[model samples]
Target: MEDMDAGRAGTARRWLDKLRGLIDPERMGDDFLYLLYHDALARRLGTCHDQRDNLYLRRFERPQIELFDLMAGHLPVLTLAGRIGGALLADHLAGRDTATLLSVGIGSGGQEAAVLTALAKRGRAPGRLTVIGVDPAVGSLHQAERAIRDTGVTLDFHHVPRFAERMTDQDWDLVRRAPRPLVMNAAFALHHLRDTASGADERNTFLSKLRDAEPDVVVLCEPDSDHHRVALPERFHNSWRHFHAVFRLIDVLDVSAADRNAMKLFFRREVVDIVGTADDEDRYERHEPAETWLARLREAGFRPMPAPAESVSEPMPPAFVRHDPDSVRIGFDGESILAVIHAVPAHA
Candidate 1:
């Protein structure tokens, strides 16, 4: 019982620390490339993440809630899915116990690793989850590695040396030549592509190679917004609507003073402003589309994996003060939608 209590306390500290790190731009550096892009958008044009729009908050909070929901509420879903997929693929290709699984977007590592480790505890860990996290963001990976600790699972943290696009063809070639029977998982990282052109350039090509590598399972998880697998329209360049969605949640559900003005300050003063984009006149509305995402995923030879819904044991209390009753979500403006995609070697 004492051990369990200690574990809980440690988890709480980690969460608080991560949140502080996320809100603090300085610590993020290149490790949080996602946040970096958002921050750039805010600074480049002088756009603002206005928290007034209920729908905006809905979309903004959508990803956060999805991460929270899957990680916090629906643990078994990920466990079962990853375990089964990992096992099947590894067994078929890597010769039972010798296969290595890869996690593309490790994030803070807490969520996926927690689920995976829980599966491992049950003796269901697939072969050897090599658990390779690839990202240009060193900070997130470093934090994740420390947080995950030694769970008896083999975790290989690859700094990615550089962002995907910057990766040399030789590096991609090496990935292409990787062994069969591996699990490659990417989550919440797909929607960042500026356009199909961006994806087609390197990521799509690399994904095509992975398809050839015949990893038993390739999984992708992203916001369930109607945008999944779709191309984000040029409209996203207009403003930082996505970021503000969460801000509204903070103000409506959590903030004591309901300091709505701070929300505005962050958006207007802190958000990025893309010069050539629409909101660049103000730098605010430019939102990423979900359509191009679909086309790209398909192009990469992946199909959607329907994620089952599971309820939380003790769900976190909704941020009522920061919430807009009319608002639908903590991230976006409504209920969060998560899309997980799974793929296997064409032959297998």
Candidate 2:
């Protein structure tokens, strides 16, 4: 048993060294680096030697909604962002007689439900509310519908089961013709749109479309990491650093060890997508820095709104909130992990 443990440790050390080597600037053009990345991820996931020919081909249990609910209850970054975002949305909805909310990538509707609850508490909910949910996953849309219904806020709900980027002309028309004072909530979703290439201009097309919708307020929550434009080596380094912080945060969560491990494991797919997708077209988790997003929003004819007022008197330590001129950033240990931006038509 001792010898087996030593062998496993040695293999892990070798994998770590290989991963480090892949991030070296001098090794940028190495053709074999992609295979190394794949194998390294497979090894780390304990599937490199599995009977399945490919790591991805092997079936792994998907993280359940209960697990995510557990994480949301304990993860400061998530809880804070949700609260801050809900507050901002509720603020925007205040004093509106009729309003429509277009939620891009409205996964499971947890955030929207929270926003509705906040508005109800403030007694500022619109007299007639219309929520348009766009997402590619039918299951998520169903879950979102249920969640929205549970809020007990009478509203018209439209589910557009399509990727935000791939929404049909009719679908967009639905948004354009929705109730007045249209507000959009795109939380951790836009980064999935495929750009022409790393650091390319294709993203601008989508942003321009968003501007055309003429939303009264657009609330965006995105990671403050540069996984989009950089090449694989830099992407690998960035992902490693970013997820290391995330995993460490998870470690201190007051949850069962198994639950904590499951939460960490849920993020493994993101790391793999960041490093393993050799072709830029195939990569979906292309997170850009907050600065990039801000610039893009401006170029798309949206101006940032004032940062949301700090509501929490004492944020948990290690989780700091920074109000920048253009957006609100939530970070752990001084590293900005997520940014919440409120923007509107420059002319608005």
Candidate 3:
């Protein structure tokens, strides 16, 4: 009886934790109350329901960032961008027998795998490949390592556990010493460098360093929303525009109701974090539009490398399924939600 009671008590505790996680104190009496309230009501009505457990903590918990794609049918824009960028770099460096790749915010290294796979398909897979991955999350680093290893490519990976802003000289030296014609992919990672104040200089400085490094090519994939604005009201409006479109996309997805609800709730946290947090909070989410990235790259002396005309006309797979297309298009689910940029230094 005692052992059985103990097990029951532990289960009850877990249940309590899950319930508590579902209720946000910030939304208890605000305009956002209706949002979570509707979710609660939906659960009670035996309709589609999201997981009650804390999902924000699981953002990068998996080895791959495909959960959002699985639940919401979001096309893998970054991976497609990576493939195109890789092909561009491979063609640019045709004389080189080996190539090195440096990825910022490599999150599970899925994008890098796509880049390598693209190179392989084109008979441009480097004789030897090296990847220098930088991310603040050690868990994410491990996941990236595992994902890269699964590809069975001749790629050497070195992970640096530091945010891009805090990277030391030694960290950069590793990238600089690698073989010439180094290529970089920074997929959905640059927005977090924003702060409460203007990040114009910081953004420029970050890109300037990359410019000085003189990598043959750098690929950047970022959200198309204007969530990086310092003002809360404007940020909320852009986020609303972005997420509302996302919700609509989720609603029509072929996924189950439970999956649909889970995706809604998962994205809700992003809206809350972007709106609720002060500018000084380091953990706040900040996303910027594609034009901002284009200007930044231009300021950093990078010139756009357009996809080949033939590749541009190639057909893309229907939504939800995973496939690499050469064209670097940003829209997803009939909405343009992200930007994929392939560029090289002005003088390179």
C-alpha RMSD for every candidate: 15.1, 8.0, 10.8
Put down candidate 2 lDDT per residue, 1-348, tens digits, no spaces.
122134465665566546544553123322123333444455544544424223422232345776677768788988888877877888777768889989999988988888887777778767778999999999999999899888777789998998877788888888889998999999999998875535556668878887888889999999989998786667877876777667667766677755665566567567768865545577789999889999999999999886657644458666888888899888787778889998989998
* Global lDDT of model 3: 0.62
Candidate 3 structure, TM-score to reference: 0.71
- Deviation in angstroms for 202 in model 3? 2.4
What TM-score do all the candidates reach, one by one?
0.52, 0.82, 0.71
For residue 133, what is the lDDT in candidate 3?
85
For each of the candidates, give the backbone clash count.
64, 0, 0
Angstrom error at residue 115, model 3? 3.2
Q: Residue 184 of model 2: what lDDT?
A: 92
Give the per-residue lDDT of model 3 (tens digit) for 173-205. Answer: 888888866988787788878542544556777
**Pairs that collide, model 3:** none
lDDT assessment of candidate 2 = 0.75
Global lDDT of model 1: 0.43
Q: Which regions of candidate 2 are displaced past 4 Å? A: 1-47, 50-62, 196-202, 311-314
Better of 2 and 3 by TM-score: 2
